[model samples]
Target: MTNAADRIAVSTWSLHRMMGTTYPHNLDTLEVGPVTEAYGPVNESLLDIPSAIANHGINRLEIVSFHIPTRDKVYLGELKSALAAVDVTLQTLLIDAGDISDPLTSDRDTRWIASWIETANELGAERARVIAGKQKPTRDALDLSVKKLTELADGNAGSAVRLTTENWFDLLAEPGHVNFILDKLDGRVGLNGDFGNWGGPTKYADLRAIFGRAETCHAKASFVDGTLDEADYAACIEAAEAAGYKGPYTLIFDANAPHEWDGIAAEKAFIEARIG
Candidate 1:
């Protein structure tokens, strides 16, 4: 059996600083066009990240869609090969853009999101996580999201790359909305519970509600004055355990100023101490 320390995973989001660059190529006119933004002349190549992460003793990774500079098959194949070389598993390919809840543009966004499933397959990822919606919570909006999400799941029927949605953005800001929509989907789509997405005194209780169905997790810990909020982090972990969640805890570390790899290592050490 895999030890608890072995269950730790990393999300490329934690290394955004080291990456120092991002790609904005996707559908959805919610903001801007696919114009390339300048951040890095990249410090490290995406293909090299697998080994970098492996060096830290993490064998699983969730990649943000934008972090992947291209959908080119050759490049995708090279990334897959890099992961194979290090024996790192691509836990999930996170499709961070698009709002399938918008009635006007959802049709276009749905097609755009579906296209990435092929890309995930190319990278040999275990799942492709999509944003359920960006619209405000309402019966019509939730139902529309469910329809689109179900369509994506059905459209990819029998795909080895499973489909997942997160408790994020306006549509799922609350547990009621999350459970409602996932229930509506009726197992068509799975959950990727994110610790930092929802906040408040009720965060722990809310986590318990949705994480029970979570196939993966985004274990984002809060920091203040450059210190980990161990209370919050511990409670979040306890909540997930209470919900009976058994999945990789993908660490997410975004700081005001970064020593991203250091922040990640700190979080990893905390988790390993508790569950190792």
Candidate 2:
């Protein structure tokens, strides 16, 4: 049995897609932040999210970078203040940059990423979720990523933030690749495990292998022929716990449905029940 300290967390992205809406009423209504697009070009509705989530009994929030203007700190500060007013905690911030695996490193990309790290620090975020970049033409790309990530980590060393690189291709498709990256990085980085993204039947097994190294997780569920399967989800949760992982688990619902929030709540209940 898992201890109470090992409770799973539900990401608002799952609820956002489930509800078919972004930025639900307020944190007071949904305890989760709907994955929203950046408002105009600079602002994010951070204050509004916590209230909606608070209403729904959710105080923890994982803000996706796609929703916030990564270049502007002043606007970010405003958003941060709004969250602080409602006692909302920023759990994880995801940044989706173009081709993380691209071999040709750009000074512009590096600068943009540096800005992101700074913004994450200002918001007091615990971790930043980054794509594995673009897939490279040669194996040397892995070494390049390690060097770049190490640099990012070094810059943020004084802050609370840690860089978590997520698996895009089959890089993390198996335990070997997962361990390979961890071993090469030497604990300087960690994995952001996304349950539904794995391409094949090995999803459950892969989760089991990497759970111990997960700093944060993305909980994604699917509807097979219009029905939600609890058994598949139960297996994912079981794997997470069995590996002795105790951290925040965010639910990311990617399906498109009008009343998807109901499904998300159900999944959360199902996982929480098993955790008990």
46-155 per-residue lDDT for model 2 (tens digits): 44666766665555678765455333567778878877887777877776563444555444455566666676788887788766556532456566666677777787
Global lDDT of each model?
A: 0.87, 0.64
The number of residue pairs in model 1 that clash at the backbone is 0
lDDT of 1 by residue, 118-177 (tens): 788888889999999999998899999999998999888988898999999999999899
TM-score of each: 0.94, 0.81
Q: Output the lDDT of residue 183, model 1.
A: 90
Please report the candidate that would top lDDT against the real structure: 1
Off by over 4 Å in 1: 28-38
Model 2: residues >4 Å from true position, as ranges? 1-12, 15-46, 69-71, 136-138
**Model 2: lowest-lDDT 10 consecutive positions:** 23-32
